[model samples]
Target: MTQSRRYWIPSVAFCAVLVTGGLAAWAETVYVQAKTAQLRSGKTSLDAVVGNVKYGDALDVIGRDGSWVEVKTAAGAKGWIFSNKTSSTKPSGTNDTLARLGHSMRGGDASATTASAGARGLDKASEGYADRTGVSARDRDAVDRMTAYQIADQEVEEFLREGGLGEYAK
Candidate 1:
């Protein structure tokens, strides 16, 4: 009975160590949240870059060192990336309000009030303020051009692909 007890204790201890080690080595999936992220050989920014990932890219998080996370890309490349650049959840889509508004406006079903407001350029209060501030038409045109510019989804996808970002890298 004494011999059996000794063997049982060692077996239980061995099993506990195995379980603990397995848990420590467990990996979690994380998605890239930045426009571009560099996978470095070390935890610091000064470390050599091993690879690059784009927004919405997925990685297997294997370990962590301070603010840096060790990750493995889908291609099986291992490196460290900043923890702030990754998210547990995948990005839903673009959050650009102006882009959404532009799509709605170009859909040809905008309300009369919207069309009127756009065509009139500025409300009376705004026009008065602009005149008082000496704002020029050139400045307004430049603003309009900047606001009117919209990045197409295809273009963004191509850019991501070219940069080996996100799903493209997968």
Candidate 2:
């Protein structure tokens, strides 16, 4: 029994090391779960965008920095994408309507609202959601062309700083 116990302990330790080593050598893969994930040059939203990965796109994870993930795109683009935008498993419904919305979030009559969505305020309805639960789909989508708001990181930082949200908030 003593001899068997000694062999068992060593065997278990060896197996543990082997398993951990094998897992470490294996590269982790993730799929983009967001409508559109911007691959940034760095691990921050303020970083320059290197590429865009669509929903359900597979990404090879190379490393991780905080909430950011370093990945290599199928097209050979190496960049950082937010960890929250990716999924451990391949996403379903890749061919679904919502998945086919394309890169632009704004759709339908997008050219209608035009310049009315800016500092002047939104005087128009844009790309209304289609809910068949209560309202008719046709009635749900009132008008389109809602101006997309693309606020820069700098602007947000300035606002937070002005409000004295705290130190190193950015």
Candidate 3:
């Protein structure tokens, strides 16, 4: 009786681990919106069509090979799809807003609003964020451009000091 119980416990534990691993491997999901989606297992053109996918269909994505996503189609056809071709549902306005702010900062158009104050605030914010993120190597150009605002602020301060505007404070 004792030997049978020991074997049964180990078998049940092994099956539980396999089942959990399998569930974790099948977590991603995707949807096909184009007329037909091309499924490829690899970068090679030899990746055969696991199946055809249709428009507005949901798929259970299993894994990825390079840039290709392995998915099971709504009709139960499993295959791979190019990552770039996947339709992303991000909000359009976010991109536009980021672009506008990026352009304004890059162009150094301070006169848009109290130019000096605006530039100082943006420059400080950018530097603070960059320091915190520490992965600013990808943001080098942006951080450099933002630093321009700090330079501009120092220039204004120097002009005021040399022009005797500093006497006004006394």
Candidate 4:
């Protein structure tokens, strides 16, 4: 090959490498829905709640896996979010609240866990009221909250159930 042609070929190859590498570094911003959302440092609430999130806001995509995405919001905030709850869904306020509840159930908040445990105990006491032919209203409320909290943890629960945790095990 001619000397000039050989130099041109290598230059083109170098440009291709640069373009591909740059694209790899390009971070994508995704929008959060207008609902309760939990952002955690890791896949579960056991990972600290990294940030409080709301709907219709953008967070930068840092990484992803099935059903989860690692995101960084403006101000350099970072966290993991359920992938399904983000972008192009109709009015998913319920899921958002569920996600937040998962955090509580997983001991994401120290104060919330204590309060929730107390509520659970109170709820069990209300079962005694059933003997009197009326539900203990307070206990019923506590049970309802507990049930909802478990449901909120369902995603992380399912992930663990399906051996997703194996990926993180060291």
Candidate 5:
């Protein structure tokens, strides 16, 4: 009975170690967050490019060196990528409001024109009414002159220095 108990204890201990090691070996998963991420052969940007990953591509993190992470792709390619280029979650689509608006306009969304006009503080109905009522050329000329006005660089610098703005702050 003593011999049996000793063997059982060692077997249980070995099994626990195996399980713990296995869990540790399971690589952490991350996704490429940049529009284009280059996986390099070394931790530094000067290293040879080993692979290219687009936004949302999955990578299994194997290790890290400073700001770089070693990873393996689903295709079994292994390389290093900047830690900043990868995220634990997949990247969402473009965050640019202008890009989204452009897409909406290109897609022919019925409300896009109205939304764009509203953004400029103008309504389509009011614009059409004004057009029908004849907008003053004087007002248009004033706007054009205002847009064409430019300040000399030296004068702008002087204004900034006087106002203690940004790098000009005392």
Candidate 6:
């Protein structure tokens, strides 16, 4: 090959790589769906925590293996995160609230982990329903009790393992 042609070939190859990398980034960009997610060093959450991601945090898709996704954080931390903790689309106002609620329900501090209910939880529709409906104080108390119930992480892990759930089936 001619000397000039050899240089041109490498330049073309470099450009191709750059283009492919850019496309891959946009194709599967995922946002953290959990209020706080630990990015592990391996496919399972049992691995060492390499980093942490919070709700709505954008993560560049590096690769995927079953229910685990390899990601690079904006701060350049690379690790594997469970697919259940991420979403293909960015979180919106409603999604953000849901994610926070999920975190709070999972035993996180109610006031710290989630946005105030008065802001996101209470809206015109909910207020209207409450005003029109004749939900008794006793029934409301029962509902509150049920919603306050929190499951331990160990129980969840055991359930997943015993049931062969998620990546465990593989």
Q: Highest lDDT, which number?
A: 1
Model 4 pairs in collision: 32-56, 33-55, 34-55
Q: Put down candidate 1 lDDT per residue, 118-148, tens digits, no spaces.
A: 6434545555566799889888556545655
lDDT of 3 by residue, 115-152 (tens): 35344333445545656878455575564556464445
lDDT of each: 0.78, 0.71, 0.60, 0.67, 0.74, 0.76
lDDT of 2 by residue, 14-69 (tens): 99999999985787999998767679899876688899888899898999988889
- In candidate 1, the residue pairs with backbone N, CA or C atoms under 3 Å apart (3 or more residues apart, or in different chains) clash, namely 57-166
What TM-scores do the predictions have?
0.49, 0.45, 0.35, 0.39, 0.47, 0.51
Tens digits of lDDT, candidate 6, 130-151: 5589766566546545656688
> What TM-score does structure 2 among the candidates reach?
0.45
Clashing pairs in 3: none
Any idea what lDDT model 4 has?
0.67
Worst 10 residues of 2 by lDDT: 123-132
Among all candidates shown, the one with the greatest TM-score: 6
| Cα lDDT, model 1, residue 12 | 97
Tell me the spans in candidate 4 whose CA falls farther than 4 Å from its real position. Answer: 1-26, 88-170
TM-score (C-alpha) between model 5 and the true structure: 0.47
| Ranked candidates, highest TM-score first | 6, 1, 5, 2, 4, 3
TM for candidate 6 is 0.51
**Cα misplacement distance, residue 93 of candidate 1 (Å):** 1.6
Worst 10 residues of 5 by lDDT: 110-119
> Model 3, 155: alpha-carbon shift in Å?
58
| Local distance difference test, candidate 6 | 0.76
